[model samples]
Target: MQKVIIFTDGACKGNPGRGGIGYYLISDAGKTLKGSKSYLRTTSSRMELMAAIEALRLLKFPCKVELYTDSRYLADSVNKGWLNTWLASPFFLNRKNEDLWRRLANEMQKHQVSIHWVKGHSEQAQHRLVDRLASRACNSPKPLIDPGYFFKI
Candidate 1:
């Protein structure tokens, strides 16, 4: 399987304000892809999860993915078995960011994924780059509407 490494970050102007998600993807074949999108209104957690979902969605075929994020909510959900517990539970309506979680879960099944947690604003260049990208995205003038945040879908 093709091996790929992804670094993701999310930035929010305020807790429930403008948010953005960023991701950087590098493949074993020396290919690179990067993206950032700003949402009109959302939470940091939603942006974090969206980063992973968007990154995985970009892949054209199934591959081995090493997804790195600075958010504990994102990393711990997968690493600490919280995602499986949530999926198995019937109380999905009570879960926060259930829409993004379900969307992320669907994208994850398309590949072999491993989620890694990294310290925010770390010395790593890739991590810092993604951080900057996310920050910039949130500050963009033309932000897109976040339906999930507005409609709670």
Candidate 2:
């Protein structure tokens, strides 16, 4: 499978407020691709998960993905095996951001994915770039509404 390296970040004005997600992807062939989106109402975790989901969705074929994120929630869920447990447990249905988790779970089935955690606001240029992208996206004049977030309650 083709290997890809992806760096993602999410930012929110408040715990549950205007938010944005960004991802930077580099293919084995050295091609680069990036994406960012702003949400009118959302949480940081949701955007973080969305960043990975959106990046995975962009892949036209199955691949080996090394995904990096600043959110330990996103990384640990997969890296520490919470995701597998959640998928097998009915109790996960009541968890916050279950919708996005399920979407991310489905996306994972399409690729060989490994999630890594990185320190936020660090000196890493990739993290800094995606961080800036997400932060800037939050200021989009006409941000899109996060439907799942609205229905979260």
Candidate 3:
């Protein structure tokens, strides 16, 4: 079975404020697959989910994927099945990051994926790289699009 590894991180200048996501993918033989950073004028949760969704969508082949993210919200929601219930009735009260979550759920169905939560800013090399990328994306002067869903809130 082909195997891939992904590391993802999200950063917010302020809660519900400017944010970004960063991710890097590696093949089973330790070859780099892809690395990306995205800016968002929104919350960290959305960035977190976007990171995962974008990483999954970047895959060119169907393979067993092991994804790592620092966000418990993203990791637990998927691994523990909470995301499925939310997708079933997405309009429930207190729902947030709906668009990103929906995108994540859809991308998730395309591959055999497993999520692992890692401590942010820890000793993990990939996590550290993701953090650096996310910080750069958040601090970069480039104009960012307001992820659209914020106006619906």
lDDT of each: 0.92, 0.91, 0.79
TM-score of 1: 0.97
Candidates sorted on TM-score, descending: 1, 2, 3
Q: What is the C-alpha RMSD of each candidate to the true structure, in Å?
A: 1.1, 1.0, 2.0
Candidate 3, residues 7-115, lDDT tens digits: the string is 9988878766667778899988878854555565677777788778888998877889999998999889988989888877736435776767778878878889999
- Residue 20, candidate 1: alpha-carbon lDDT: 92
Model 3 residue pairs with clashes: none
2 against 3, candidate with superior lDDT: 2
Against the true structure, what is each candidate's TM-score?
A: 0.97, 0.97, 0.89
Give the winner by lDDT: 1
lDDT, model 3, position 12: 78
Quote model 3's TM-score. 0.89
For residues 98-118, what per-residue lDDT tens digits would candidate 2 score against the true structure?
999999999999999989999
